[model samples]
Target: MKKFIPYILILIALGIFAGYYMYNKPHAETQGAKADITINPADLLAAFELDETKANAMYLDKIIEVKGKVKSINEVEQGGSISLDTGNEISSVICEFEHAASIDGVKVGDEVIIKGFCSGKLMDVILVRCSL
Candidate 1:
């Protein structure tokens, strides 16, 4: 009975560890899925009052999707970035794509939807994969 008790405890511990691992592991859908919430850069600017530091920190390194008018498109040999007008009077949101494939076919004045991990006030956004 004593030997069995130790084995049972070990089994229980293993089960708990396995459960935790599964629970915390990133899902395939989540890794690729855009942020569930839709936000406009203008609205975000107004709500946060253009607090770049605060806003950047709040959204930084997080996955988000935003819709706005493309104010400008910057293309480089390697890749490029875009700035969304967000209709905000004071500021625009910058979305940067490190890879060229992400920004292909995007143009200024076009309304676009972007998704990616927020690196800062500037979003290190992944462009092509978003469904919207």
Candidate 2:
């Protein structure tokens, strides 16, 4: 009985350690998740008020999400695409999704929130996800 008691205690301790490890382990979706910081295009435009060239230079290859209205829908040989107005007075912001068909339900002039990673000056944003 005494020997069994020590074994039981060790097993219990190992079980607790396993539970804590599982509970604190990083999730696949959040392993490299970007910071939750967000900047509204309108506010960013108003604050920095950068021209297209400057804005392009600043936001290129950066991770950002912008909320705006859909200005138009376009279809190319590659795939469908949507343009978003960043509430910028100078130039409209554009976001292109690899699979534009996913956004088929969205139409011109619909308000939407878009999250993506910025690619370059062309506002070559990759739409990670979006919502109306």
Candidate 3:
């Protein structure tokens, strides 16, 4: 019984930890409310251009606020995607808004601020769960 007691305690601790972790899942609203960093779209793109791996380490999975000029916009059934000029003709910051509920009146050439999780560069910086 004494040996079993330690095993039982370990199980209980693990169960508690699992419960706590499950309770704290990532949510967009909460993440947008608190950005880890704020930077311009051009600067963010420049970082990746200089060193993709290093930039990924700095921005990946982090909530970031970016301000830039709108390059283009595309609407989809679910929502939409906005491309912000990164000062590079080839690449831009693509912000994916899972729900375009609030993207009314937005147009090209307009400057906007976006907050989302950085998913690293793929020819362009991708930001998911974006909010204006």
- Taken over the whole model, the C-alpha lDDT of each candidate is 0.65, 0.59, 0.89
Residue 54 in candidate 2, Cα distance off native in Å: 7.2
Worst 10 residues of 2 by lDDT: 123-132
Per-residue CA lDDT of model 2 for 61-115, tens digit only, reads 5556677788777775554666776655445555655566757798899887765
Q: Assess every candidate by TM-score.
A: 0.57, 0.52, 0.78
Model 3, 3-109: lDDT tens per residue? 89989999999999999988997675623388899999989999999999999999999898998899999777788899999778999999988777656788999
3-61: candidate 1 lDDT, tens digit per residue: 79989999999999999999999633323575855677676655455576776667655
* Candidate closer to the true structure by TM-score (higher is better), 1 or 3: 3
Q: Candidate 3 lDDT (Cα, whole model)? A: 0.89
Query: Over 4 Å off in model 3, which ranges?
Result: 1-26, 30-32
How many clashes show up per model?
1, 0, 0
- The CA lDDT at 81 in model 1 is 78
Q: Evaluate model 3: give its TM-score.
A: 0.78
Ordered by lDDT, highest first, the candidates read 3, 1, 2
